[model samples]
Each structure stands twice: as structure tokens, then as C-alpha cells.
Target: MPDESKLPISELQPDQIVQAAITSHQPWGITANLIAYESVGASLDVIRRGSEPGVKALAMNLPPVGTTIDLAIGALRSWHYEPWVWVDLTCP
Candidate 1:
């Protein structure tokens, strides 16, 4: 296995699927700590596969905190001191 702590998001393959543990919920989405990339987290702003633009995704159906789920990489964004990952749900 690769050293997760040293892995960079830029090195990930396109549309790669990864595991992440749910951390918390926000009004916009859920926060999850990634398993393949230690110290890295993803912001699942768009939970559904075909959610329309401007439509709000409901967190009621999302996994609860501590649950590990598979997600597909959407993009890499920088919001603060480090690069943040944006992911899409890989399963229903």
C-alpha cells in the first residue's frame, strides 16, 4: 500500500474511487476524512449523481458520522492552507 499521508491529490487517477469516513454534516454537505489520503478530507457538496443545479441536496439520506463510504473524485480545490478534495457519491 502506498503511504497515504504522503499521497497528493494531484497524483490520483481520474475518476478514481476512494474510501472516506464521515466526519460531520453541514448545511451544504457532509465532511469526510479520506482513508487513502491521510490528513486529507473531502467536501461532498453534491451528494446525488444527477442533482440539478441550484437544487439543494438533502443530508437526511447521507451516511451518518463515522460511516465509511466510497466516493469518486470530482475535483481538487484550495480553500485554505491545503488542497481540498471535492467528491461525488459512488453508490446509492
Candidate 2:
């Protein structure tokens, strides 16, 4: 594993899998804390494609705060100048 603490957000590449701890519940998804990059925030869209409706429903139920999950880096997005990590649900 790379030195997570020293890894800059800009250095994060797509398709890299990482563990993140869910921090809060969102109506549309969940907000997570990227375990490797403290400065970056992660989000997962529970209703995304590739999963069945039932599976999506289960995911939509939401995990308790602090639940850790494995996710792949889909893309980096900016919101008001802040960087956000969008997890990929398409990859296994």
C-alpha cells in the first residue's frame, strides 16, 4: 500500500480501490470518509446501475454511520472548489 497520509488528493487515480468509512446519511446516497485520504470526501450513489432493484433497495436502506466499505474510485468531481470522490459501482 502507498503512504496514504502523504498521498495528495490530486495523485488519486481512477479505478483504485480503497476502503472508506461512512460518515453520514444522505437522502440520495451516503457520505464517507476516505480512509487513505483524510482531506478528500467520498460519496456512493446507492441506486446506481449494475445492481438489481432489490439490491439497490437494500443499499438504499443505508448503513449506520462509521460502516466501512470497499469502493473503487470512479472519478473526481468538484463542488464549490472542494474535491469529492465518486465511487464506482460498475466494477466488481
User: How well is each residue in 56-77 modelled by candidate 1, as lDDT tens digits?
Assistant: 3334477789999876666655
Model 2 CA lDDT for position 9: 73
Worst 10 residues of 2 by lDDT: 83-92
Candidate 2 residue lDDT tens string, 26-80: 6666777777674675777665642745336547456689888776677776655
lDDT for every model?
A: 0.62, 0.64
lDDT of 2 at 85: 42
Give TM per candidate: 0.64, 0.66
Runs of candidate 2 exceeding 4 Å displacement:
1-6, 48-61, 81-92
